[model samples]
Target: MTIRPIVRYPDPRLVLPAQPVTVFDYALRALAADLLETIHAAPGIGITAPHIGVSLRVVVLDLDPVEGARTYVNPEIIWASPEMILHREGSVSMPGVNDEVSRHARVRISYQDVDGNLQTEESEGLRAVCHQHEIDQLNGVFWIKRLSRLKRERLIKRFEKMSRN
Candidate 1:
């Protein structure tokens, strides 16, 4: 598995909707493995295929803090609780900046495993927020989009200033 470079914000690809994976082939499996490796290397909790420019509906999450890795293909949030929770979210793509975003406190997600088996799981707390955040990435949405308009504009300015340097 190799470490893939994460595409940062302002990259048009980040806003482009990802394509769904129709063929579960060896290459896809390898990509998933590489994604897991990259996430582990980043020491991050979650990653999406689009982050690396693949533009596939895939995400790797490791919230276990002890277990290995959890891979999700074509993940979708089937249900979410009305209760919302605010989490300070950061992204590997958007480095050095954390923003508070309100997301569902609980969610039930359905996705396919690396082996093509469908899996559904309920997550809460940080795991829930992380899953939703990563899933949003697959849909060409970023956590900053969940913020207020003024906040998003400020963040864009900040990112642009940083990129200029």
Candidate 2:
């Protein structure tokens, strides 16, 4: 397993929009593999290519062990339910800090697999939350940005303190 280093929070790369994967080849497969390894090492339920400074529109989610991990290339939300849910969200980039964020309770996403095959998925609950979260990351919107300014500032302070200790 090749575990790539995760880019820490506040890195400009984390806020830069990721480039879409246009080539579906061995190298793309390798990057997906590396992403799976990296997310597992991060011990996170979901992760994006930007999390590892790849600047590619890729995401890996291991929300269900029985289902195994899934890779999404150039994932984007195609539709969202009117219902909303509050879920605690965090990031591998900014570990040890999390806050509740409101998100669509259900979402339909259009994406490509590692092989560059187009696919779509409809998800709810935690899976839906993860879909939105990682897609936001790919769009250069970190999870913390979903929080209110006050909450974001507080969370950053907490993270900063944790880093120092």
Candidate 3:
């Protein structure tokens, strides 16, 4: 496993939608492994392929150590709860800054395993938040975009100031 460099905030690549994984081979597995290593090194609960400049629909999440890490390829949200919840969200690309963002309280997603097997999961609470966050990343929607204009600007300023120090 190798920890790859994470793309920082405001990078155009972060806003570009990632392509779906067409091939499930060694390279895909390698990319997933690298993402796991990278997220661990980033000290984050979740990460997407786009965060590392890989435009593939891949996500790695390690919410519970006992549950271990999971890799999702070509993930898509199949359903979401109308009920919303506010959660503190941040990005691996944008460190040292976070803000509360509203997201669905529950979500059901359909995705493929690293080996290209189809799977589905229903999640609520933190896991639900994470699934939405990472899926948004894959769709070229940065977490900050979910914020209000004022909140977005403020957080951008905070991230900018932190970057300079």
TM-scores for candidates 1 onward, in order: 0.94, 0.98, 0.99
Q: What tens digits encode model 2's per-residue C-alpha lDDT throughout 57-115?
A: 98989988799989999999999999999999999999998999999999999999888
lDDT of 3 by residue, 58-120 (tens): 999999989999999999999999999999999999998999999999999999998899999
Ranking by lDDT: 3, 2, 1
Off by over 4 Å in 2: none
Model 3 residue 120 CA deviation in Å? 0.7
Worst 10 residues of 3 by lDDT: 156-165
- Sort all candidates by TM-score, best to worst: 3, 2, 1
Which scores better on lDDT, 1 or 2?
2
User: Across residues 40-135, which tens digit of lDDT does each residue of candidate 1 receive?
Assistant: 887688998998989899898888867867889999999999999999998888876778999999999999987778999999999899899998
Instruction: Return the top candidate by TM-score.
Output: 3
How big is the positional error of residue 19 in model 1, measured in Å on the Cα after superposition?
A: 1.2
Instruction: Please give the lDDT score at residue 149 for candidate 2.
Output: 94
Error of 3 at 82 (Å): 1.2
The residue ranges of model 1 lying beyond 4 angstroms of the native Cα positions read none
Candidate 3: regions farther than 4 A off: none
